[model samples]
Target: MSFAEEAWVPTTETECRIEGWSKETHQHGLQVRSSAEMNAQVVGILPAYVINFDSHNFGIEFQIIGSDRGWLKIRGAKDDPNRSKLPIRATYPGIGWIPGEQVAFMVQSGSGHQRPDAESAKLLDLKGDWLTSMGKIVRVVACSGEWVLLDYSLGRSRNPQTLALKRLTEAERRASQGRAWFRGVCAIQETSCETSWP
Candidate 1:
């Protein structure tokens, strides 16, 4: 279907993030179906693995490219810093279809300003002078289908804007198993990092 023909909606507007299905819900892992229906061909599997959220090296992130009938087609972030280093082939250029129920859309009320804590993130190209230059260091607050809510700090002002995901660099890709061991170990514990947040 054409991009214009598809009915794409953001999973969450407040936070702008989408989460994969948890292991508790699907023990075998999240399957990437060829179509939105249950009988569709199984294209791949996004394994269900747990990570230490308290650690700096949390997990890989995916960008929603398209959606239909409660199914989302996602791909790895293009400018992910760890993409080239990941061992899994599915992650570096990961792309597949997953059920809508398998994903969690996060929404935050208010401005919901989160301290810039992500190790690294790149701004997607907005093709407009009003937006920050493509690939500029940005603090990604949340992401939905096609758009990412980013915080661009220039001097004293913090500009929070939503831009297309295609414009950003892929900083990291999600592995089939949802485990990214290449991020290395977090030198500081969660408690120590908490003190650093503003």
Candidate 2:
């Protein structure tokens, strides 16, 4: 489907790493499905892993190209971060698919979790310049099938855990650096962050 974007130039290639399926996957790891649908095919079994979520069972972050339905696609094989938290060790660059829904990218606007240079992205806005909203967090600007393009700040500020542990205000941890291509079906959008961490 064609979508008109009002934010920055949409990007497919990203320097930042994307995450998928978050669970206590210490058993036999997650299965890399051959196809997009469930029960498609267990092409491979990836060892359970964890990302930057502290204690959660997430795999290492890497260049996840895109997603289909609820799965994140790995462009090339990626391995879990070298460590014990990885449950089972899969060499480097393990190949597979991730359940997109399992990821919770809840970005809040006005919390430094929106566009890094939103004004610049607005300046780069191709169409709907007037409609360019740096408002309401990162609004869905465009979509290629299940992938929606938007800007977000990935930093300590975005993590609720850090907020409570560090006793920091969201404003202090803001780090919206650039845009990201995400499965629109799975984004957890938030405009007001009234729920502050205790």
TM-score of each: 0.35, 0.39
lDDT of each: 0.35, 0.39
Which model scores highest in TM-score? 2
lDDT of 2 by residue, 13-121 (tens): 2222443233424567666676556877677665554534554334433445555544566544445444443344653354555555333333222322123332322
Candidate 1 overall Cα lDDT vs. reference? 0.35
RMSD from true fold, candidate 1:
16.1
For candidate 2, give the lDDT of residue 109: 27
lDDT of 1 at 87: 45
Q: Candidate 2: TM-score?
A: 0.39
List RMSD in Å for every model shown. Answer: 16.1, 12.2
Error of 2 at 28 (Å): 1.8
lDDT of 1 by residue, 57-159 (tens): 3233455565554555666522223422334434333666665445432211112112212332222212232222122212333334323343332211223
Cα displacement (angstroms), candidate 1, residue 190, comes to 9.6
Best by lDDT: 2
**What's the lDDT of the predicted structure labeled candidate 2?**
0.39
